[model samples]
Target: MDLSELRVEIDKVDKQIVELFEKRMDIASQVADYKISTGKKVFDKEREDQKLRAVKELASSEFNKTGVEELFSHLMSMSRKLQYQKLASAGAAGNLPFIQIDSIDKASSRVCYQGAEGSYSEAAMKKYFGEEVNSFHVDTFRDAMAVLEDGSADYAVLPIENSTAGIVSEIYDLLTEYEHYIIGEEIIPIRHCLLGVPGTKLSDIKRVYSHPQSLMQSARFLSEHSHFEQISMKNNAFAARKVAQDKDKSQAAIASALAAKVYGLEILEEGINQADSNSTRFIIVTNRKVFLKDAHKVSICMEIPHEAGSLYHMMSHFIYNNLNMTKIESRPIEDKDWEYRFFIDFEGNLADSAVKNALRGLREEAKMLKILGNY
Candidate 1:
């Protein structure tokens, strides 16, 4: 046959395929009704595996076999989603563990942040909870989390990521270790400055101090002055305080202007960070597992089997449900060789139908899954 005739034949086959797809979906709806009446679950992994193998066997060539398997996987996922929607409509969807609240009571809340008074985390806390909030400072991020868990503080502000330095891995691990829920998030613009004690000049400085992340963010500035010895401190504000207390003209720190003001230091240089749009995202975490009713973002962690196509199969749930994944990060599992845990942020609330459907599939397919927060 000619090329036009062959293309026409393909179109005819596609039309037939669409008709069959509609018919199959109708039957799947009836199946959903039967399962709902009998209180049966929506997912049957063994059945799905068997069907996939059966469909592959119907293909003539090796390439066609793989294609057929992929095609059927998507079809089955669609059918499962339809059933999930029906289940949700019938109020049979499983309950979420988080309690929904109208809003966070920041006015009366006691907040905690890591580092000294002039740190970026303190700035984020002030921005999120306002300046009048009863706030205190802790030495480390773990200490801040401990205060929140022990009821010493109603909320804790912790940095999660930076636009230039990437994610704060320690904070992610702390979230897994501590039982805290992220109720809100705030982003603070970073404006790094070179701070030194009074009468200290740029040429008089020999040693510079700052947080490890700050040092990294100010790499260009540090590299330009290779003669200056770099020292990493627990926090930028702590570095500034140390420089002030030492009263050494040779010692300086890379910190914010607030730190300079708090510690009585001069800003020798401003905007030292390489990126002009540097900013850090901080999470507002509380011990209670509650989310605001208007929450529109969800964070989750899951572990998938270390096997071929396992990750792809797991991600298909989000794709099939039309969930827009905002970010994904992977961390190595402790003591588990070659295994990792995945953290995902998606644009949806736990109360959403699409989110419910995606979570249902993830719970069944993933080796382990946890809802980190909804905010």
Candidate 2:
């Protein structure tokens, strides 16, 4: 056949495919209605696997076999989405476990933050809850979680990410380990300074101390002073306090300007970090599973089946529902070799239909699923 004739054949096949697709969707809606009355699940993994294998067997070529499997996988996924929509319209979709509130009662809430005074966590807490906010400090993130668990504090403020150094991994682990939920978040600009005892000069410094991440952030400046030994402390504020207590002119701390004032130390150098726009993101966590009514961001974590295209198929839920995913991170699962848990942050409220649809699909397919929060 000539080129035009071949093109005409392809168009004819495409038209038939579209019409068949529409017919399949109509049947899927009927299936949805049946399941709604019967209370059956939308996703059937064993049935999907069987169908995929059957389709792949019909393909005569190896490459075509793989393509056929992929094509059917998408078709099944689309059908499931349609079924979920039908289920939702029938009021069969289950309600989420989270409660909604107009706003967090900050004035009456007692907050807890990790690290001592003048640390970045404190700054973020003060920024979010006002300077006069009732707050206390703990030595570790776990301790902060413990306080929330025992009802010692109403909210806990903890840093989850840094713009320059990346995420605070412990915070992620703690979130999964504890039953706390993130109610809000605050971003604080980090301005690291080289602080020393009063009247101390740069040349007199023989040792530098700060949190490991703070030391890393100021690596460029610390490298120039190679003669000084770097020591890691629990927090930057602790380092400043130690330097002040020891009255050691030979020791300096890389911390915030607030640390210098709280410890009564002088700032020998300011803006020591490499990045001028360095900042840290802090999350406000509470023991209750409640979120603000106007919250627009949802955080969830899940573990997918250990198989090819599993992750891709899982992500298609977001694409199918048109949800905007903002960030995704993976953490190694404890005691599960070669397996990881995925944490995803997306723009959607828990009350939205699209969010419900996506969550329903994910809950049915994923090995495990947990909604971290909505804020």
Candidate 3:
């Protein structure tokens, strides 16, 4: 046959395929109705797997077999999504484990932050809750979480990630360890400075102190002065306080200008960080599982089975539902050799239909899934 004849035949097949798709979807709707009445789940992995194997075997060539598998996978996903939509409409979809609130009360709420008075977490808390909001300080990030768990504070502000240095691993692990829920987040512009007591000069500094992240962020500056000893403290503010109290002309700190001011120290060198636009993202966590009604972002962590295409199949749910995933990070699971947990940040609220469908699929496919937050 000529090329024109082949093209015509392909178009005719496409039309027939469209008609079959519609008919299949109509039958899927009936299945959804039966499932709803019987309180049955939307997804059945074994059944879908059997159907995919059967469809792939129908193809004569290996290439066509792969194509058929892909095609049926998508069709099955669509049918399952339609069933989920129907279940949601019928009020049969399971309830999410979070409570939606109109807003957080920042006016009278007590806030806690890791580090001393002038750390970035403190600045984030101030920016989120305002200056007049009652706040306290803790020596470590765990201490901050402890305050929240013990009902000593309404919210705890802790650094989750930095633009230059990547995620705060300790905080991520703590998120899994603790029951606190992240209700909000704030980003603070970081300006690492070399702070010292008044009349101290950069030439006289022999040792520098700050948080480990601050030290890494200022790695370029610290490398230039290899003669100086670098000491990692619990926080930059605590380092600044140590320098101010010690009255040592040979000791300096890499901390925020706010820390310098709070500790009555001078900025001997400004903008010491490697990147000028460096910033840190901090999360506002609370003991109660509550989220604001207008939250537009969601964070989740999941562990998928160790099988070929498992991760791909899990992510396909988000793509099929048109959910935009913003960030994904993997961390090694403690004591589980060669296994990891993936933390994902996606742009959608729990109240969204597409988000609901995606979460439903993820929960079904992944070995474990946890909704970290909706904010």
Candidate 4:
């Protein structure tokens, strides 16, 4: 056939495909109605597997067989999403585990934070709760989670991510381990300062101490003074406390200006961190499964089967429901080799129908799913 003739033939086939697609969706809607009436689940893995195999066998070529399977998978995914939306509209979507509160009562609540008095976590807590907020400190992030789990603290502030250094991985694992939920987040700009005892100078410093992340963040400044030995401490405040107690001009700490004031030290240098806009995100967590009424962000974690296209299919739930996913992070499962859990942050309130539909679809398809929080 001539080029124009061949193009005409292809256009005709495309038109037919579009008509067939709409017809198929109409049938899918009928199926959704039937399932809604009969209380039957929308997704049937066995039936889908059988149908895919049957369609693949009818394909004339291997490449066509793979393409057909992919095409059908998407069609089935869309059908499932449609059914979920219908179910949500009918008020069949299950209730989320969290309770909605008007607001967090920060004034009367007792809060806890990781690190010592002058650490960034403490600063975040003060920023979130207020300067006069009643709060205590823990030695580690896990200890902070423990306090929340034990009901000793109404809220716990722990760092989850640093713009310069990346995520605080331990916090992710602890979120999975404990029943606590994040109700809010606070971001604090980091300004690493070189702190030392009175009369201490850059020339007098021989060894420096701070959290490992702080040391890494201040590498640019520390590298210039190669004579100073870098030592890792549990927290920057603890490092400052150590330098203050020792009263040694040779010992210095890379910490916050707050640490210098709290520990009676002097700031030898300021803004030592590599990035001027460096900041850390801290999550305020509570033992109760509650979210603020105006919360706009939802966090969830799920484990999908370690199979090809598993993650893609799970993500399709978000796409089909029009949820704007902001971030996704994966962490290795502790005892499961080659398997990982995904943590997703998306912009949506729990009360929205789209959010309900997406969560319902995910709960059905994912191996395990947990709503971390809405904040």
Best candidate, lDDT: 2
Tens digits of lDDT, candidate 3, 232-328: 9978999999999999999999999989888999999999998988999999999998888899999999999886667877888788789999999
TM-score of 2: 0.98
Residue 45 error for model 1, in Å? 1.4
Ranking by lDDT: 2, 4, 1, 3
lDDT of 2 by residue, 226-245 (tens): 99899999999999989999
Candidate 1: which stretches are off by over 4 Å?
A: none
**TM-score between candidate 3 and the true structure:** 0.91
What residue pairs are clashing in model 2? none
Candidate 1 lDDT tens digits, 1-375 = 999999999999999999999999999999999988999887898999899999999999999999999899878878887887888788787888889999888899999999998899999999988989899999999999999978999999999999988999998888888888898999999999999988888899899999998999999999999999999999999999999999999999999998998888999999999999999999999999999999999999889988767788778778878999999999999999989999999999888888987898788778889888999
Q: What is the model-wide C-alpha lDDT for candidate 1?
A: 0.91
C-alpha TM-score for every candidate:
0.94, 0.98, 0.91, 0.98
Q: Candidate 4, which segments miss by more than 4 Å at Cα?
A: none
- The per-model lDDT (C-alpha) reads 0.91, 0.94, 0.90, 0.92
Worst 10 residues of 2 by lDDT: 84-93
Clashes of each: 0, 0, 0, 0
Decoy 4 TM-score against native: 0.98
Pairs with steric clashes in candidate 1:
none
